[model samples]
Target: MSINQIQDEIIDEFSLFSDWMEKYEYIIDLGKHLPLIDEQYKDEEHLIKGCQSRVWLHAGLEGDKVVFTADSDAVITKGIIALLVRVLSNQPAEEVAQSELYFIDKIGLKEHLSPTRSNGLVSMVKQMKLYGLALHAKS
Candidate 1:
């Protein structure tokens, strides 16, 4: 789905819940949707820095696109990471490089997140996008 469609879906889901607690529950559910990675890929090379939780992200160039796989030890944080990957994964490097992350503002994510979590999320997104940019340059 397009990122706009993903944003619309997330807004709809969050709107159904009356408070942050339920919204958080939805986010956790989103994490559950992430695909499981191979046990071997769960290594330090894939690990994401800056997050309080242990997050592992792996990306590779597939044809002209970049595909990502990620996981996190914390459920809610995993969900947040999954949300980022959902909108960014499996897209062309150019699209990933040019894209603006609109979901963060639409979900009011930064406001609800702790300062550390917010910074970590930014780092995660930047890392994934940078991987795409580097792959684009190589190809």
Candidate 2:
């Protein structure tokens, strides 16, 4: 599926929850399902700064697409990265870089997060796009 299609599926999934508590539970569930990054990739360079908890994201180019692997010390934060990776990974570099990610607002994710976590989300998106850009240039 395309990036937007995957994002739309997520939006549909999050829309089922009626309240923040339920939504958080769903997010934590998603985190639980996130395929973990390798131990080697979980080191210093992949660690995302500005997060209250440790979040490590590693990206690699496969053929013409970019694939991402990530993990986090926090459950909710792990879910947040999982959502991003679901939409962004295994996609063309240009698509990943230019992704609109409208689902963040549609699912009320940004508004529900604390100020610090919100900043971390922004940083995560920035880093993902930067990875996309780097891979795009190489291609």
Candidate 3:
């Protein structure tokens, strides 16, 4: 599905919960379902900065699309990245770089997160876009 479509789906899921606590629980559940990142990609180079917790993200081009793989030491961070990967992974590099990811604000994620986690979320988005830019350049 397109990134916007995927994001809409996420928003729909988040809307199901009337409270932030329930939403957080759902996010944690999403984290549990995240595909494991390969051990080889867990090195320092893949680690995202600005995050209070350790979040490692790796992206590679497959044909004409970018594929993301990630993991985090914190469950909430893992869930955060899972949402990103769900929207951006397996998408064309240019599209991934350009995606606005409105679902974040739509779902009140940034407002609900602590300041540090919000910064981490920004860093993760920046990193993903950077990877997209690099892959787009190569393509």
Candidate 4:
């Protein structure tokens, strides 16, 4: 699916929960299911710099699309990355780079996070877009 379609699906899913606690649980569950990143990519080069927790993200081009894989030391952070990966991974490089990730605000995810976590989230998006831009240039 396209990025916006995926974001809409996530918004729908988050809307099912009645409260923030349930939303938190759901986010944790999403984290649990995030596909494991390759051990080789867990090095300092892949680690996201702005996150309070350790998060490693790697992206590669497959055809014209960028495939993202990631891992984080913190559960909430992991889930947050998983949500981003679901929306941005396996998409065309330019599209991924330019996409507007409105789901962050649409689901109130940004407002709900701690200040540090919020910064981490922005950093995550930035890194992902950087990857897209780099890979797009290569192709």
Candidate 5:
């Protein structure tokens, strides 16, 4: 589906909930929908260092867009990574580079995360954006 469609869906899901717990449960459900990453991709190169949980993200350019596959050993962390991928992945390199993570604030994610987890989430976003910028430069 298109990014707008994904955003609409997320908005719809969250809008239905009046409680933070329900909203988080929906986000976790969305994460469960993400396909599992390949075991081989869990190596050091793919690993996102400095995160409390083992989060791995692999990105590639498909035509003009950046595609990503990610996983985390912890369930809630995996959900967080899935949410990040949803907001950032599958866009043209230039678009990915320019995109602000509007959803992060809209979803109140930072308040929900511990300081370290929040920092790790920022690290993940920076890495993804860097990969997109590098691809834009190469192209």
Candidate 6:
């Protein structure tokens, strides 16, 4: 699916919950299902800098698409990244780099998160786009 389509799906999913507590639980559940990142990429180089928790993100090009893999020490952070990856991963590099991730606001994720977590989320998006830019150059 395109990034916007995926974001809309997520928005739809989040809208099903009646309250923020249920949304939090759903986010945690999403974290449980996030694909594990390779142990080799868990080094300092892949670790996201601004996150309060340890988050490692790695991106690679598969043909013209950028594929992302990530892990986070915190469950909620892990789920947040999982949401991002679901929207951005396996997409064309330029598209990933330029995509507008409106789902964060549409789903009210930013308002719901702690300030530090929100910063971490922004950092994660920046890193992903950086990877996209670099990978696009290579391709």
Q: Rate the local accuracy (lDDT) of all candidates.
A: 0.74, 0.84, 0.83, 0.84, 0.73, 0.85
Instruction: List the candidate 6 regions with Cα displacement exceeding 4 Å.
Output: 112-119
Give the range where candidate 3 is weakest over 10 consecutive residues by summed lDDT.
111-120
Models sorted by lDDT, best on top: 6, 4, 2, 3, 1, 5
Lowest lDDT 10-mer window, candidate 2? 111-120
Cα lDDT of model 5 by residue, 36-113, tens digit? 577889899888765466678888889988887888776667787887778668888887776666555666666534
lDDT of 3 by residue, 1-139 (tens): 9999999999998888999899899889878887759989888888775546777888989999999999887787788788888899999999998888788889887753445554466777888898898899999
For each candidate, give its TM-score against the true structure: 0.83, 0.90, 0.90, 0.91, 0.83, 0.91
Error of 1 at 6 (Å): 2.9
Q: Report the poorest 10 consecutive residues by lDDT, candidate 6.
A: 111-120
Worst 10 residues of 1 by lDDT: 111-120
Mind giving the per-residue lDDT tens digits that candidate 1 earns over 31-122? 77766466788898887665466777788888987888888777777788777777777788877887787666767676534555543566
What is the clash count for each candidate, in the order shown? 0, 0, 0, 0, 0, 0
Give the clash count for model 3: 0
Cα RMSD for candidates in order: 2.4, 1.9, 1.9, 1.9, 2.5, 1.9
Measured with C-alpha atoms, the lDDT of residue 41 in candidate 2 is 91
Query: Could you tell me the TM-score of candidate 4?
Result: 0.91
Clashing pairs in 4: none
The count of residue-pair clashes in candidate 2 stands at 0
Q: Please give, for residues 34-64, the per-residue lDDT of candidate 6 as tens digits.
A: 6659999999988876546777888988999
Q: Which runs of model 2 end up more than 4 angstroms from their true locations?
A: 112-119
